[model samples]
Target chain A: MDVSEQIHAELKKCGVRLAASLPDDWVAPLIRRLDADNDIRHVPVGRESEAVMVASGAFFGGVRSVAVIGNTGLLTCTGELATLNLRHQIPVFCIVSMRGSIDDHQIYQEVQGRRTIPVLQAYDFPYRVIDRPEEIGCIPDAYQWCRLQKRPFILFLTRALLKGRRWS
Target chain B: MIAKEAIRVLAAHRGDAIAVCALGVAANEWWDATKAEDCFQMHGAMGFAASFALGLALSLPNVNIWIINSDGSLCMNPGCLLTEAAQAPRNLKHFVIDNQVYQTVGAVPMVNAGRTDYAGLARAAGIASTHTIDNVPEMEKQLPRLIAGPGPTFVVLRVEPDPSHINTPPVTYEGPEMKYRFGRALEKRFGISVFNSSGY
Candidate 1:
């Protein structure tokens, strides 16, 4: 399967029935997959932090949820992750669109991109970077690790991985 | 007088009602003795208290949710009133206690000072039944009636800030654990499985 399909399958395997996101070019395919799937409730939020809050609420309501946003979105959600997620022990699966990293074309993306890993570390969040399409399948493992650790986890999706050759 | 009466009223009708309070010493005092479904002690997020309570109310429609918000905090997120009025969840009740100042932050006078009109604001926000009570007896008498009445309701309790109390230690929780516990509770209460197979 392709990265999109792989992500969908991984989320399914992880029991994620609902996913909330704000629009971002890097994760558009994944968002589209979520929208197409009738079984998954895809909620588009106004703010990235709102998406985190929605996912947190969904988790509280017995739904396993994930929030997809870009790097800047991560900045918006630092307070929620720290206050509601880290402080309150609310586990949310975060898929961060990698920007401003190696081979990144966007100039503005470098600011938060370089700070992503450190930010996650400050929150003591365990995360992984997916540079290739094959690594998409490792999502289930990452999610499992988060569940077992009982903390937030991040999956960094590089532009190449998202736009690379289809797996299927 | 106001604190004691409000607590007594809440204690008398403790069902599955969830009470949320904004950040302050008074809220901490109220939370000390009160045991409801969930006592949301909002720390940094000021105006989001009512909005968060609204989300909880929507998630658990069977239970009644109450928000004890301060006037200062309420003013910060006034848009919440419009949203509350628009959504109009009958199970949610918002109580705005107007103390006229940022009592927790050295009792500084807010810009508008003691001039906010909560009842009128509620009316403008489309809340049908709005009530204001100053004394203990009035609060005791009106609280139950308001709780029993169809809502989304707004009750503004006018009072002076208690000078004797100090700010409490901040409460924080592990996000995942709290979510899991609350999720399990919701699953048991609603009899529906929200997760797929992996048990998130």
Candidate 2:
């Protein structure tokens, strides 16, 4: 299965009934796939923070949710993630495209690649980078650990895993 | 109308709606008016209360979700209107307490004060049912229609800022306690487990 398909399968296993997203090219395929699924309610938000807030609210409704966005989008929503999810101890599962990696080669994304992990570390938000399709299976475990942690946890999808020919 | 009085009217007519309140004045007023645990009083994420409420509404399809937003908070993320319009959740109602000032921060005047057309903005964003209530009587008159109407409906409640508002503070509990209280309240109300067996 493709990386998107593999991730989708794991999300289903995690019982993610709702997904809120602001798409970046790297994660767009996965967003589109989830958007087409009937079981997962896809909310296409205007801003990245809206995706974070929506997923936080879904937790209150007793629904498992995930926020899908690109790395820059993830950077933009740190305030909301900290103040809303962190302050309230509300666990929000976020799947972010790992932008600005060596192969990503985008000048606009360079700052994010260097700063994202440090910022997340400053906030004490746990995250993991999935560099291969085989690592996609850990998503369900990550989701469960996020719930147990009771705070925002990010699962980063590298361009390598997403665009890797092995998946095709 | 005073913001508190307008909130009282809304609280009275809230029915079975689960309310999501933005931080600051709107949240304080709702807390004072309703003192209800079913409401999720946001401590931060100034503008996304509307989005949060939309998610809750979508998840709890049978429940009514109300977002008590503020002008300051709304302007912080007006794009929320576009998202809300796109979702068009019939069970979600958005109320913006437009006092034209950030009352929490010593009544700082809002940017473009008294000029922004929030109702028109919501309409332009594709929410067909929208209204602005400038007084208590007007709000009372429109409450039934607004309450019974299918959403996403946008209502802007124009009210006077309380110069004496320093006396009114937010709900006392802070941080994680608020989460547990609100989550446990929902769990009891809907018979759903908002927490795990370990009580996260």
Which one wins on DockQ? 2
Give stretches of model 2 more than 4 Å off.
A165-168
Off by over 4 Å in 1: A1-6, A32-44, A102-104, A163-168, B1-14, B20-22, B36-55, B71-91, B111-158, B167-200
lDDT of 1 by residue, B82-185 (tens): 65676577988888777777777877886687676888988997888888888787876777788998779898877776665454433343334434454555
Worst 10 residues of 2 chain B by lDDT: B161-170
- Residue pair clashes in candidate 2: none
List model 2 lDDT by residue over B87-158, tens digit each. Answer: 889999999999999887889899999999999999999999999999988888999988998988899999
| Cα lDDT of model 1 by residue, A6-33, tens digit | 8889899988877777767889989999
Look at candidate 2 and tell me the lDDT of residue B72.
94
True lDDT of residue B79, candidate 2: 97
Query: Chain B alone: TM-score in each candidate?
Result: 0.83, 0.97
- Which window of ten consecutive residues has the lowest lDDT sum in model 1 chain A? A53-62
Instruction: Specify the highest-lDDT model's number.
Output: 2
Report the number of the highest-TM-score candidate.
Answer: 2
Tell me the lDDT of model 1 at B27. 67
